[model samples]
Target chain A: MKHWLRIEAVCASLAIRSRMAYRLDFSLSFIGMFLAHLALPIYIVLLYGVSAGFGEWSIGDMLLLTGTIQLARGATSMIMSGLIWHTNERVQQGTFDLLLLAPVNALGHLLNRSIDFEDSGLFLSGMLVFIIAVVISGITWWQALLLALLASFAIMFFASLYILFAAITVRYISTLRLFEFQDIAAQYAQFPLHIYPSLLATLFITLIPLAVVGYIPVGVVTGHLPMIMLGSLIFPVLFLGFSVWYWHNTLTHYTSAGG
Target chain B: MDIITITDLSKTFKVPKRKEGLKSAIQSVFRRQYETKHAVKNVTFRVRSGEIVGLLGPNGAGKSTIIKALTGILSPTSGEIRVLGFEPFSQRKDYVRHIGALFGQKSQLWWDIPPADSFTLSQHLYEIPKQEFERRKNDLVEKLGIQDIIHKPARNLSLGERMKCEFVMALLHRPKLVFLDEPTIGLDVFAKQAIREFITYTNKEYGTTYILTTHDMDDIEHLAHRVIVISGGEKVFDDSFAALRKIAGVTKHVRVVTQKKVVLPKKGVRGVMHISPYEAQFVLDREILGIRDLVKAIAQKTEIIDLTITDPPVETIIAQLYQAKA
Candidate 1:
């Protein structure tokens, strides 16, 4: 418990420092993100006006999904995206060797020591949507809150997956396709998962498991998924564990490129 | 007892050969070839507690490779490395607890944060107790004279100031074994001297065992009691400074400036050679020259304005050693 607290304190301090280093950039990014979030609901409202229900769901249900996904994505972006960039820079500059020699868990060091604050705006925007959606959709208070927490964990799991992919790229140095795939995945997450075919919907739930981020949990909360789909919550924990394990093994194979 | 021991350590890397030009680049992407490069080959050494040893070598001489292997950052192709009685590569966490490493070209501190913050982070990373961390940090900061700059961001500090802070950061945990790779690179003379003094004081005062790699011969001369020189992945020379000079046939160069421009005799005097007009220099050949006679001849000159003598540089001696081994 003490070690975990220390990690959290250190990570938080690093994030705060990084944010303060570029105050103007931080402010600009936050404002831009807030405006972007407001723009998204407007776009969705226009679409709903032109068309009837987005694939078996009302406009209110779609708004709830949008809020959940935005919140999860915002939290992950704020916390874990910085780690991906840090891993890449460390590998290229050969600074990763310094961390490897420290008497600490390498994955813990990398994941906790770096963070980005611009994503906080996204989180806030998502929270606003979440509150509005809960009021309009009439979700049970306890169940809705529980799913919301689960959605956050799922976001962290996906972020860890991104970090793992970046670490692998350090070794391979040629598998840039993973990045392109992530960009496409981001676009997919922007909309409701039901619009996609059943095969892809299953793929998103199982293979990538992005559905758990906001879609599945919100779907379960809104009565779209039966209690059987509560099993999806297990995916985040299992996937996070797998990512942590892969990170340790892959780090051992790190041959620092230069002196 | 030896704090670090390695046997037949070797590391080989597979480097992909990429073709240049737009045409060849596209063609080679599908049919890529790789060549194996041996970074460290059959290299072995041991460092006892409280010894400051220098790993001397030129660029691409596998010095950094060997350091990385010892630190458990890179697994050797084949070898045994025991640091603090544990296999470094297998028991990295346990082994690394007794070690601290600093690469001069890298900054372990967060660039945008104060050094004090980085130090706190390190304290937690190493699991140092609160009281112990404070005491050690205060002592190190005081000793290194970085109290004034500890709160400033690392990127805003000068090179020397940043390096001083880096040194303090590495040593705050008080590890028994320290590896410093080019710790004084790009620093001015004053900063370099400060670092050298600190390393010497730490080795003597705290009995810290250090394995330092540097291109600066002066650093080796000042701090290293023993040096291990490697070339082309092979250990070329490993011995004391005096012994290395003797075995490499390296000697001092003495330039004697005469009061008048006297032409040296056609038949050169024993133990002395006329290297330039009016400038007579002596190479002490154990076969023919004696130091007393050389000095007596220079004294006989009308007047000697100033004379200087210096040993051949370590770089030259190292180059010659490599050539001889080749």
Candidate 2:
């Protein structure tokens, strides 16, 4: 784990250097992400003022869900977005061959070499919004803290899922459709899970698991789910293990492109 | 003991056949036809520790494929390969520590970071201790003349400078076997000379075994003591440089220039054939051609204004060998 952290730190440094190469573009993109997060809450507030509630959830509850999901997504993006882009470039350029020949795990090298600082703004904004929603909705301190911890773990799970998808792209050579699928899933994550039909809700909570990002943990904080469902928190650990296994399997199939 | 060995190693690729135009591309996506190409076919060679072997071939002649197979990037369709007493296809971590590689057209350096950053990362990846890493890093940077460029981002360096840094990066871990594919491809004359000299020095100073594949004839000519030529996925010749020249029918060309034009009879010349007008050029089989006699015969004809003898270019010899194989 210490070795992995060292590798990750190296990757983060490389990523910062790469981003700094295009300083103007990186600055503009960072501002754009900040504004984009700011706009999301404004839009949600207007919608909630117009409607009484989204199913059983109030405006504050919806804000919590949005904030939690955005925070998780932002953190995931911060850590893994650059890695995804680098993986695609490496696969396309056949530089992945050089990485494979190196004296380290190729998957670890590919997945941990870069981080995006732009998304940190979105993450910070989401954390602020989550705190505001917690204060406004009058949640207890311990429940609020537990929800925050669960949200972080859920973000990690989502990141693992994204890494798994990236690994699949490495094998299949295209992930645009996967990106589209994630976009639609993000739409569902913005609202309470109760707004969707039971089967669809189960699908989100189980297979896709975007519900864990905001819906399930928020549901627990709001007392919507029974205590038994809290046990499902263990799924993230299992999913992480499975994603890593899948990544390794896909890595074995990797045939780098170009000379 | 042999450091690397291959027995009947082969790799066949299934390449999809795609038609031009957007409509056909979309239509064929559901029903694509794939043709199997035998990239490397039943090649077998072994290299002992501390040997520098050159892999010489034309474009798409399976040189890179063989290198990839040896490095565990590509799996062979059928055959067995062992590198440093480990199966490379298994991609065992212990085995990877024994090998290093540098591809000429591609870089392993972190593009937007200093070469030193890449070396540091590699040190961690290879799990080298700090002192040892620093020692090796300084030695290599100095030896490769990349000290000036080591602190510059890889993208900012010239091709030669970047290649120098790349060489240092590949060797920082001190792997026993190094594979260099076209390591001097795009450099100017001086840079190429520098790289060649460094390669020689590295092989000798560190006792690192090298397997280099290059299209540059001079690269093979200067650095390779033993040359292996592969044509059409098969090893056509594997021997010393001199032996390759002899086996490829490479000969010295003797050009005789006379003051007056003369027609020579083709029949009675002991060491000459394929003669042309005002100047006659002869192919001197090293065994048959006595240089003094050839000069004397030329002198007997009209006035010998000038004479120059030269060996066939290496490219032509290699091309002729390829044509013969085809």
**Candidate 2 chain A: worst-modelled 10 consecutive residues by lDDT:** A174-183
**TM-scores of the candidates, chain A only:** 0.88, 0.91
Cα lDDT of model 1 by residue, B1-326, tens digit: 88888999999988888778998788777887889999999988888999899998888889999999988888889988988888888788778888889999998888988898888878887888999999999988888888899999888999999999998889888889999999999999899998998999899899998999988767877889898997888888898866665666635566777877633332223356765556777644432444565566656755667676655555677777867668
Give the Cα lDDT of each candidate.
0.79, 0.79
Task: Indicate the residue-level lDDT of A135 in model 2.
Answer: 81
Q: What is the Cα-based lDDT of residue B212 in candidate 2? A: 96
Taking the true A–B contacts (Cα pairs closer than 8 Å), what share appears in each candidate? 0.73, 0.63
Off by over 4 Å in 2: A174-177, A234-239, B20-23, B249-319, B322-326
In candidate 1, what are the lDDT values of residues A149-222, reduced to their tens digit?
77766686667677777678667764546656654665676666878899999887887777777677777777
lDDT of 2 by residue, B190-308 (tens): 99999989889988998999999987766877999789888778887788887776666645667777777754434333355435566776676554546676666666767887787
Q: Compute the lDDT for candidate 1.
A: 0.79
lDDT of 2 at B278: 67
Error of 1 at B62 (Å): 0.6
